[model samples]
Target: MTSKYMALPKGMSESSFDAAIEKFKKALGAENVMIKDEQVRPYTKVMMAVPTEEHTPSAVITATTVEQVQAVVKICNEHKVPVWTISTGRNFGYGSAAPGRRGQVVLDLRKMNKIIHVDPELCTALVEPGVTYQMLYDYLEENKIPLMLSFSAPSAIAGPLGNTMDRGVGYTPYGEHFMMQCGMEVVMANGDVLRTGMGGVKGDKAWQVFKWGYGPTLDGMFTQANYGICTKMGFWLMPKPPVFKPLEIQFDEDSDISDIVEFIRPLRISQVIPNSVVIAGVLWEASTCNTRRADYTTEPGHTPDAILKQIQKDKHLGAWNVYAALYGTKEQVDVNFKIVQDALKQLGKGRLITEEMAGDTQPFKYRAQLMSGVPNLQEFGLYNWRGGGGSMWFAPVTQARGSECDKQKSLAKKILNKHGLDYVGEFIVGWRDMHHVIDVLYDRSSEEETKRANACFAELLDEFEKEGYAVYRVNTAFQERVAQSYGKVKRDVERKIKRALDPNGILAPGKSGIDI
Candidate 1:
């Protein structure tokens, strides 16, 4: 298949590429292997404007069966070709559904989406990589089951495997999805399959319950790394609470963030706010709610100083918003909500706004976390960037380092401003750590904007690293830069792990910038 974006590297041979494609088609079946330009084109680009020319896959394969995935991996291993796995391709702000390396085959697993088992007695479900939150919710509702699963507010199209693989957190008490994962079925680079926890031992009931193995806890090794392809996983689910209440608390001053975070830390550790917490800055709130307002859209290339002026004039500057939920029996929710309200009042701030939804109040009951409500930012179609374009850099930050976060935000805004780009999304994930997602939104049609966005992102990474921040999740485009952020020791350790698991270095080469 030929594509304008498919620019083969120098010294690469057409004969070699064609042979690789033929071998892949033979192994995975021609029907499952996509060599047509139309099928391969969309898999070439991610969400960011960082040109798709660098990581255009030679083929896009949709594996409907684990046996097919194993066959494809074997063929790729023999040829020493890289493979990048993607599920649903709904990973917005980061890279959409694109491989991190060029000439690699994209393993699209959306077709394998299925909820294999939902055990109400154990409150756990075994799901394939393709299962999404919306799908799970609909199925449970249809079956008249009583349970709640945590989900991100962005696109419900994201797969359960993709989100958990990235260690993405949600808005419920069980917001830390990866932590709840008990077992995983991974396809290694050499085509060998491995299962973690009790899944390795036949007929063990603890396969989806206990996380520890007799030797090592290897579940974390698969996350945020290209060591293997996760086909199946078991995750814990929450039982339906007798009563759920969503609450919101607004703070008028920026300084209040530190106090608020401190107040919530103990509560979180005590399992009071077990799900997750979000402390959204005022500018972030304004961008999502009032984009149509003349105040925001009127000025193109508005400086940070000007935006701050507008925010202050609008009485929204330094407005810190928090979302939290209360679960359990009616008495439990009532008692918890009162305690939270009283705590907020002591801080000289507290307000409750009624949510639009009534039944199953799980979404609105959270005041410290932001994932429950429908992610309003996604409504603008900002996450979906057509063509080979758009990108996001997510990093974890300490909530106590409010000053440092402010500095980082300032630096990011200044860098994007210099490049004539917008710093679109920012929010807190864990109560004490911040997930500052900077969306480099630009039209793929504009070559200049795309180039500027890439350069600006590179520069921002440098600044963020110098300031002692680390990336939680990175795209294949900036793999090298992200790797450089980690110190020599950590990088060395990561390389060793990669080499041990993938000796041939044929799985996701150039991804995460590990040479192993």
Candidate 2:
């Protein structure tokens, strides 16, 4: 059953490619190995500023079991083929499921979805790569398991395995995804299986509970790198709280961002507010429900400040919106809520929006849902802000200081406006660090807009680096530049590790720009 001969992997002729395809088909069945044009189209959708063909997958192989993944990797190793892996393939702004380089087979693992184990006593879970947040949430609810999940904004469609492996963030107290992970099961490039942390000990019961397994921690390396395919992983789940109260604090002026950061840091560090707080911009709050720029104005590029003020007034939102929560029993929540209230009150610029007042609002509802471990897709509405469906998340990390937050915001806004783009971004305040996430939204259909967006992204990197600021995560297009933002010695060590693990380069080649 052959459709048409398309491009093959590098250094391989059509016959050799056909032979590799046959081997894949034989290993996973013909229905699971997708080489047809239509079957591979979904895997080619990329949001980065690069040619679509450059990131297209040559074939897509879906495996249902760890043994099947091992067999497929063995075949790719034999043929000197590179294989990119994805769990649920819903990483929207970060290239989705597309490989870093083109002409590689996508080891799509959506078929291997299974919740292997759930320990209610320990509040731990073991799941396959395909076990999505929504699936796990439903399972816990159905079984009346009193455990909650920590997931990103795009939670319902994204899997825990993919998000956790990427070290993504959420809104809950367990917002730090990777920090909460306890165990991981990886399928190496050489077709060997490994269990990290306590999972290495045979018949060990603390694999998922105890993270440190006696030696150097290897789980951090596999994350955000293409060293191994994580077939299964175990993560700690947030136990059900006796009480939950989510709060929203809105400031009237954009300049109030500095004070908000200053005030919230003490609360966050003091555990008065145990969860990660989102200090979102005005545009970010509005975009959750506002679909088009034309709705307010026909002006192109960044939305005018007057128009933004109008949006803030009409939407009853703030120049900056802060979403945080209080957990524990009713007594504990009341005490902590008072502490949070006092913190905001001292700022003298923040207006607290209680849960009752913010009932079913844009940023408020979504933030509450995330903090409670309920998955929702309302965050995707940001893609419709400028139309044309172009997006790239430019995330840079900084100290959770108000002054640093203010400086980053000002610089990013200036660069974005210069490029004729709007600053639709937010700051998720960690205990001591903050992730300043900005979505570079533009109209991909317009060639001019695309060109400017690309230039703007490059300049953002350069200017940010000049200010001693470094991006924490980036889209697939600028991974190399982001990697080089650090010194050469760091990348040298990464390359050495990549070569040691994947000598044949059969794993992801350009992932995070570590191609050795």
Candidate 3:
């Protein structure tokens, strides 16, 4: 017979767990504390190569105020109960809603969502963890504030606080979410409230405008760590430009990746292309446009290159699709667009497709929307590529050099194809770096495919590391392995910090593989 719950924290007695749940209910109100298996099931849903049971949360606690969060942390410390904190719990492909490991109570902060303040004049905002991109966008629109929001593709559901804390990038001038952040309000594991940057100063006027206060900047420390739960964040917003022009340069062959990066790097570094340029593979583009594996040959192994070529031909797509935009006044956009056109001309073969030519044609439409600071869920089409309800983001950072990108793409494709999976990936071009994001898609319903996907992810990690490459982030199942990639010294330092701040390890014991 199954116990009353799916799982509990290791070494904790059932009676102790019950007592902790009682205390949590008392602190968060009965409606906020959820313990039933069904009520907690949604938080445990994971899309990794592992079973959902592996990441199942023991219970869920929703906190609407910092005082409630402090109380929860105190109780967790008191009972030595670890809690996994999530802002909106919309972290898809990176363990959405699930804890870093099994049995940790989920501290649901979606209820704390509040757009605390917005200064249209200064183009800054102070928001709680639950304020989603769509929420802020709506707020700006309803109030007639002329501001642009740069958010991840899943902007409709994901929040700024969570995305910034995770260091997620978007497709705009202020795409580097963390860098755009000015301040933060975090609840430490010891039940203390810590404000970073200008938030610490009493009646500080520049809390949302200044990122670095006098002392050591602690805003970054709380990110991607279990040391604290972030309740509020402050960040800058791009003022709506007078004119926006989105463009796509399509390259015919897979080998053209090298030339694509070579030509684009200079323009990006020089700020001619101000937005985060995305060089998406054909499959990635196709997937975003609702193309499914079933549309092509589905004969088990990787889709044949011949079929891929045919899809490109039929859909009027390029093997390597480059997406970026020009924003400024009419004259400025025209000049920048001409400069971009001149750069693409250097490639000698990039087919430039403008917004008018795209004409609501998928991928490009959504991509343009993203580059223009519009929130959309169209990128979720990646799941329909394999139709297995399984996906893991295998992201690795690399220099924005032609040869480096080519090498990484070749290596990734070789590894993925060797395991009979397709290489559906993209290179998000930054100022001087590329965030090579690959969605490792598989059909979890098939035991064989699931096994292959798991093995493929591990081998991808191993082989990529051998080539001096490591992932920037990973799903819950592989946090420990990814942590090892940073080396032992860093791990030791993190452990020391965890011990110092969270002696009882009550806040997400396995988060980023750090624990007391």
Clashes of each: 25, 0, 0
Task: TM-score each candidate.
Answer: 0.88, 0.98, 0.99
Task: Score candidate 1 by lDDT.
Answer: 0.69
List candidate 2 stretches off by more than 4 Å. 1-6
Question: Which runs of model 3 end up more than 4 angstroms from their true locations?
Answer: none
**lDDT digits (tens) for residues 272-348 of candidate 3:** 99989999999998988889999988698899999999989988899999999999999998888888877667668
Worst ten in a row by lDDT for model 3 = 338-347
Better of 2 and 3 by lDDT: 3
RMSD in Å for all candidates: 3.8, 1.5, 0.9
Instruction: State, as a TM-score between 0 and 1, how close model 2 is to the true structure.
Output: 0.98
Error of 1 at 99 (Å): 1.1
Q: Lowest-lDDT window of 10 residues in candidate 2?
A: 1-10
Model 2, 184-296: lDDT tens per residue? 99999888999999988888999999998988989999998989999989999999899999888888899988889999998999989999999999888788876467889
Candidate 3 overall lDDT versus native: 0.90
Sort the candidates on TM-score, descending order.
3, 2, 1
